[model samples]
Target: MSPYNALIGGVTATLLLGFAAQAQSDTLADIRERDVLSVGIKNDYPPYGYLDENNEIVGFEIELVRYIANELLGSPDKVELIPVVASNRIELLNSGRIDLIMATLGVTEERAQVIDFTEHYVSAAGASVLARQEARFDQWEQLEGQNVCGIQGAYYNRTLTDHYGIRLVNFTALPEAYRALQDNRCVAMVFDDMTLRQKLGEPGWEGYKIAVEPYEYLPMAGGVRKGDEAFLDAVNAAIVKAEGEDRLIDWEGEYDMPPSDHIAARAEAARAVAE
Candidate 1:
C-alpha cells in the first residue's frame, strides 16, 4: 500500500479502537468483572454516611447500597465503600472511580446533565438555622446582618446570603460549621434538618433547637454515571423494592427517627409505578 493509504488505514483502526473502549466503559459487565460495586459516600455526614463506633462505615445510605448489592449480586458483602467529599462525588462517578454515589446527593438539572439519578430515596429541604433557645427568625428577611454558618457547598448559600441578606461563613464540613455555632462564632449554623436533629439529640446538644421550619423541599437520589441504562435500571429496581417494603424507612429507624409522612407518601407513589 502507498504511504498515504497506510496512514488512512491507521487512522481508521484507531477510531475503531476508541469506539470499542467507549463501549466497554459504558456497560455494567465491567462492574461484575471487578467483583465489587464501588460506592461513593460522605464519611462525615451523620445519619446518612459516617464511621461507626466499631470503625466500620455505617449509615442510611450505606445500608441502602448494601441492599442494592445484595439484590443485584446475591450478597451485600460485594460492595466496597469509598469515602468522598462534596467536591469530588461527581468527578469520582464520571471518572469511574466508583460505580455509584450513595451520598446525600440532591437531584438538580445541572447535575442531571452529567450523571443519572435513581428514583429519590430520601427527600431533603433547604438548610435552616439552629438556635440556642426560644429566639428565632420567622422569615428569611429577619436574618439580616446576623452571622450564619453552613457547610461550604450547601444548597442554601444563595438564598441565605443573597436573598436573605445574611453574612454567611462556610466550613469544609458539618462538624466544623456546627462547632462555629457552638463557639458563638455565628448566631446559627445551617445543615440538613435530619442531621441537625440527630446532633441536637446528642449528649452535648442541650441548648440548640431548630430555629425555623424547613423552607423548601428537595428530593435526594443516588448518582450514577450517565448512559448506563442496565445499571441504572438495576439500581432503580432495587430502590423501588426497598421503598415498597419500607426498607429505607426501617433502615433509618435503626439510627434515627422513621421516615416522615411525606417520605412515606412519596415512597408509596414510587412503589405503585414500579410494580
Candidate 2:
C-alpha cells in the first residue's frame, strides 16, 4: 500500500477506535439520558427471535430486551429493536450502530476476547446433526466422513470439523444452510438444538431428523462492546432482577419454552455472578 494510503487507513483506524471507546464509556448514561435502548436481535430464527405475521419482531429474546430497557430507561417502550443475524451483530455493536445484543449469541472463548458477555440468561444443549431419518448416525464418529451443512462464524464449526474430522460447507445465513441441506449438497446439517427442533416441525423439512446431537451445551447471554463497566453493570443487574421477579418464567409460557435454572440462581445476589 502507498504511504499516503497507509496513513489514511491508520487515521481511520484511530478514529474508529476512539468512537468505539466513547461508545462504551458512556453507554449506560447515554441510554438513560436518551431514554432509548438499541438492541440487535434475530428476526429469522423462530421461538428465540423472529418476525411475527404482522412483521413485528417478536420472540423470547425480544421480551428480554424490553425487560433490560425497562430496567435502564424506566419503560420498555424506550427500546428500539434492530434485526440482526449471526454474521454482523457484533460488528454493528462495535461500530456504534447498536447498543447491545440480545440475540442467541452463545458464550465462547474466541468471542469473549472481543465482546463482554453478561451472566448467561439462558442455557442451551440441543446441538444435533439433521439428516434423513433413514440415514444412520449410530455412532457419533460416523460423521467424520460426511459433508455437513453449518453456519459460518459458529463457535462449534471448528469442533465439528477439526475435532470430528467432518467436511463442513458453511453458510452465512440459516436459510442458505437449509437450502444446502435440502439440495443434498451436504448429507446432514449441524446446528443448535432448539433451532433444529423448530425446523423439524416446519413444512418441507420432512424425512429429516437429528442424526447427531450437538457436542456442546452453551450458555446464551447478552453481548456488549468491550470496556464500559458501568453499562455492563446495569445490564447485568437488570438480568438478575428480571430472573428474580419470575419474569423469565413468565416469558417461558409466552414463548412456549422452559425456564433456565442457571439464570434463576444468579438473580438473588452478586456472588461472583453476572460478570
Candidate 3:
C-alpha cells in the first residue's frame, strides 16, 4: 500500500476503535467494579434534589437514587451525587459524564429523541409563578407586561414571553433567579410548581407565594444514555420495585409534599408494570 493510503487507514481504524469503546461501555459493570453509583441530580430544585442547611445535597430524588444504589451496590454510601441543571443534564448523560440522570427531568417527545428515559416515576407536574404576595398576581392574564425570572432553556420562557408578552429575566441557575426574586429584581419567578412550592414553604420566604396554580402538567422520569438496554432495564426494574414497595408514597411524605392523587395513580401503574 502507498504510504499516504496506509496513514489514512491507520487513522480511520483508531477513530473506529474509539467509537466502539464508547458504544460498548457497560455502565452497570463499571459501577459494580468501581463500587460507585454516580447519578446526576439537581442541587437547586428543592424537595426533589437540593442542598440542605449543611450544604449537603438532600431531597426525595436524592433518597430515591440512594435507594437504587443500596439495592445495586448493597450500600447507599457508594452513591456519588453529581449536581446538574436543566440545560446540560442530557448532554452530561450522553457525553458519559454521569452514569444516570435522576434530576427532575420532564418528559417530552423532543427530549426522548436525544436520550432514553426510564418509565415515568413522578406524576406530571405543572408550571407556576413564585411571586411576592405584594405583586398582586391573581391569574395568568395579570402577567402581561410583567418581568418574570426564569431558568435558561426552560420551555416556559418562550411561552411566558410570546404568549403573554411578559418580559423574562433568564438565569442559568434557579438559585440566581431565586435571589433575584428575593431582591425584587423580577416580579416573579416562573418555574415548575414543585420547586417553587418547596421554596414557598421554607421559613425565610415569608412574603412569597405561588401567584397562580400550574396551568399544564408534564411527566418526569430518570434519564440514561441511549443504546444500553441492559443498564436501562436494570434502572427501570429498580424504580418499579420501589413503586411496588410504596416508596413513592413514603417519598412524598418525607419531602413534605401534599398528598397527590396523580402521584398515587402513577405509582400504582409503575408497580403494575413491575409485575
Candidate 4:
C-alpha cells in the first residue's frame, strides 16, 4: 500500500539478498576452515538417503556426499548429514543452516532461482502412479478427477493437479503416504518412479504395480546457496571425479538399485574427459 511502506519492503529485500550473496561467496573456504561439510540430506528416502538396519543413515546419496567430503575435507567422516524433507531443504541451505543439499533435489527453473545446482548427475524419472495390480489406468490423463497420493512440496504436484486434473492427497512424508495407500485411501500413490520401482520388489508390494509410467524425467543435482561459485565448482569437480572412477556404478550395485544408462553414459564421458 503506502509508497513509504513499499520502499521499506524493497530495501529490506535487497539487504537480505545481499546478505545471502555474501554468505555463500566464501562457503568453500568456510567448510575447509571448519574441517567439516554440513549437508542437508533425506534420511527417510531409501536408496538415496535412509536409515539402515543399524539405524545409521546410509544410502546412495549419503555415500556420494561422504565421498565429496573426503575429496574436499580429507575424510568422509568430516561431513554432517542433516535430515531434510522436500519442503525445507532449500530453506535450510539458503538460511545457512547447512552448507549444501545432496538430497534428491531435482533441478528446476523455480529452484534454480533460489539455489545454485552442482552438475546434473542423475536423469531421474519423474512422478509415476502406483496402484493395485488389477487397476487399469496407465496414462497420466486417465486419472482425471481421481484421488492420488503424493508428497507435499514435490515439484510435480502442480502439474499433476493442474495439467492432469488429479486430486492429490498430500502427505508430509513417504511412510504416511505409503500407509494411506495400503489402507486404500486413494486410488493410487504417486512418487519418484525409481523409488516406487524399488518398493514393488519389497515383500508386501507384490500385489501392486506401477500403474502409470512417468510423463517426464528430471535432472537431479546437489544444491548450494546461490552464487556459491567456488564451492559449486569444487563439488562439481568431485562429482566428475567420482564419475571417472566409476564410483557411482559401484554404489548403484551396493544400494540394490537398477542400473541406468544415464549414469553409464556419464561415467563413460567422464573417463573420456579424464584421459
Candidate 5:
C-alpha cells in the first residue's frame, strides 16, 4: 500500500473510534451513575433565577425544577443547580455539565436544532419604548433612528435593530439596561413582558413601562442535550404532571406575577394531553 493510503486508513480508524466512544457516553447513563440530575439556571434574572437576601439561589424556575426532580427521581433533593449565563446555557447542556436547563430559555427553531425542549413553561412577547410613561411610541416602527438598550447578547437585538429599524445600545446585564433606561441614555429598552414587569415594579421604576405593545409571543422551555431522548421524555412527563397539578403556575406566582392568560391556556392544553 502507498504511504498516503496507510495514513488515510489510520485517520479513518481514529475517527470511527472517537464516534463509537461518544455514542456510548449518553446523558442517561451519567445521570443514573451519579444518581443526581444537574440543572443549569441563571443566577441573576429576577423572579426566575436569582439570589435572595439570604444569599441562596431561589426563584420560580428554581422551585419548579425542585418539584420536577422530585417527581422524576422520587426525591427533590437529588438534583444540583449549576448557575449559567444566557450565552453559555446551550454549551453547558451540550457538554453534559448539566442534565437540564430551566433558565429563561426562549424556544426557537435554531436552538431546537441543537437541544431538545420540554413543553414550554413560560411565554413572552417583545416590546420597545423609553421609560417615560407618557411617551407616545405606539408601535415598534416608531422607534426608527432611536437608540434602544438591551442585554449584551439578547435574542431580540437583531429583530429590534435590523427588522424594526431601531438603533440598539447593548448592555452587559439587565440592571445596566434598566439603568440606561432610567438615565435616559436610550429612548427605549426592548425586553419581554414578564421581565419588564418585574423590572418596572422595582422601587424607583416609575418612569419605565411597556410600550409598542407585544408584537409576538415567545414560548420558553427547558433544554436538554440533543440526543437524550429518555431524559427529554422524563422531563416532559414531569412538566405535564406539574401542569396538571397547577404546580408550575403556582411556582411562577410566588416570585413573579400570576401566570398570564397565555401561560394558563398552555398549561390547560398540557393538562388535557396528559389526561
Candidate 6:
C-alpha cells in the first residue's frame, strides 16, 4: 500500500480509539450532570430484582442500586431502573441505553471482554433442579437422559447439555419454563438455585422440591461498559460502603433470602478496609 493511504488509515483508527475512550470515561460525569443513575435490572427474578405484589419493582438488587444512587446522586429516587434480561443486558449497556447493569449479572471471563464488572457482591448458587417431591433423582448425573426445563441464554445451559447429558427444553423467560414444568412437559426444571429455592416456598409449589442441588456457585457483580473506570470506581466504592454498614445483610432479611457466608465475609472485609 502507498504511504499516503497507510497514513490516512492510521489517523482514522487513532481518532476512533480516542472517541471510544472519551465515551467510557465520561459516564460518571454525565450521570452527575443529568442527576440520574440509569441501571439495568431484572424485574422477574425474585429476591434480586422482581415485581412485588403491587406490581412495583422491588428486590435486593433494586435496593442496592438505589443505595448506590443515593451515594452518588444524593437520593435513591434519582435513578432510572430499566428492565433487562440475561441475553440483552450487556447489549443494552454497550449501546448506552443503561449506565450500569445490576441484573443478577454473574462475572465470567467471556463477558469481561465486552464489559467491566464491579467488585462481586453476591456468590450466586448455580443450576439446581426442581422436581416433584416424590421424584427420586437427587444428583445431576442421575438426570442425564431426562428433559429439563430451562431458560434460553442461561450460562450453564451448554454445560448441562454437554457435560451432564440433559436435554433442555429452553424458554425465553422464567414463567414459561416454570409453567412448562407444572404442565409436566419436562421431568424437571433447572435454573439458578436461589430462584428455584424461592419458588419452592411460594404458594402452589408445595408438591415440589429441589431434586438436585447446584453443582457450582458463581460470583455476581454489577456491569458497566468497558473502560468506564471512573463510573466503575464510584459504584465499587458505594458497594463497599453499603457492605461495611451491613446493608446487604439487612436486605437479605427483608427479601426473605437465606443468609450467605460470602456476604458476611465481604461485610467484614469492607469494615476492615474502612478502619
lDDT for each candidate structure = 0.75, 0.77, 0.77, 0.85, 0.73, 0.86
| Residue 126 displacement in candidate 4 (angstroms) | 1.6
lDDT of 1 at 120: 84
- lDDT per residue for candidate 1 within 1-275, as digits (tens), equals 11232243244333333332353254467777877899998787777888989988888899999999998787999998999865666666766789898887876665665677988888765566688876667666777889888777565677778887888888998888877888999888777777677778888888778787677777789987767889999998898888888887787688685356666886788778877
Sorted on lDDT, highest at the top, how do the candidates line up?
Answer: 6, 4, 3, 2, 1, 5
Name the candidate, 4 or 6, with the larger lDDT value.
6
Per-prediction tally of clashes:
0, 4, 0, 0, 1, 0
Point to the candidate with the largest lDDT.
Answer: 6
Write out the backbone clash pairs for model 3.
none
lDDT tens digits, residues 1-275, model 5? 11232343344333343332343246766777888889998788777889999999988888878888887777888889999866666666666678898988877655655667888887755553445787788888888889888776666677777888888888897788877887889887877666677767778878667776667777778987766778778888888888778876787678767457666786788778877
List, residue by residue over 1-275, the lDDT tens digit for candidate 3.
11232243344334343343365467888889999988999898767888899999999889889888988889988998999866566656766778898988766655555567887887646678888877777788788898888888776667788888988999999889999988989888888787688788788998988887777766678987666777888888887788778888898898798666776886778767766
Q: What does candidate 6's lDDT look like per residue over 1-275, in tens digits?
A: 11232343344333444343445657999999999999999998878999988999999999999999999999999999999877667767776889999998877665665678998999877788999988999999999988999988787888999999999999999999999999999999998787788889899999999898889878889988778888899999999999999999999999988788889999999999999
Question: Candidate 4 — which residues are off by over 4 angstroms?
Answer: 1-19, 129-191, 203-212
Count steric clashes of candidate 6. 0
TM-score of 2: 0.65
TM-scores of the candidates are: 0.71, 0.65, 0.66, 0.71, 0.71, 0.71
User: TM-score of predicted model 4?
Assistant: 0.71
Clashing pairs in 4: none
Model 4: per-residue lDDT, tens digit, 144-246?
A: 9998999898878898999999999999999999999999999999998887998998999999999998898777899888888889999999999998899
TM-score of predicted model 1? 0.71
Model 2 is weakest, by summed lDDT over 10 consecutive residues, at 1-10
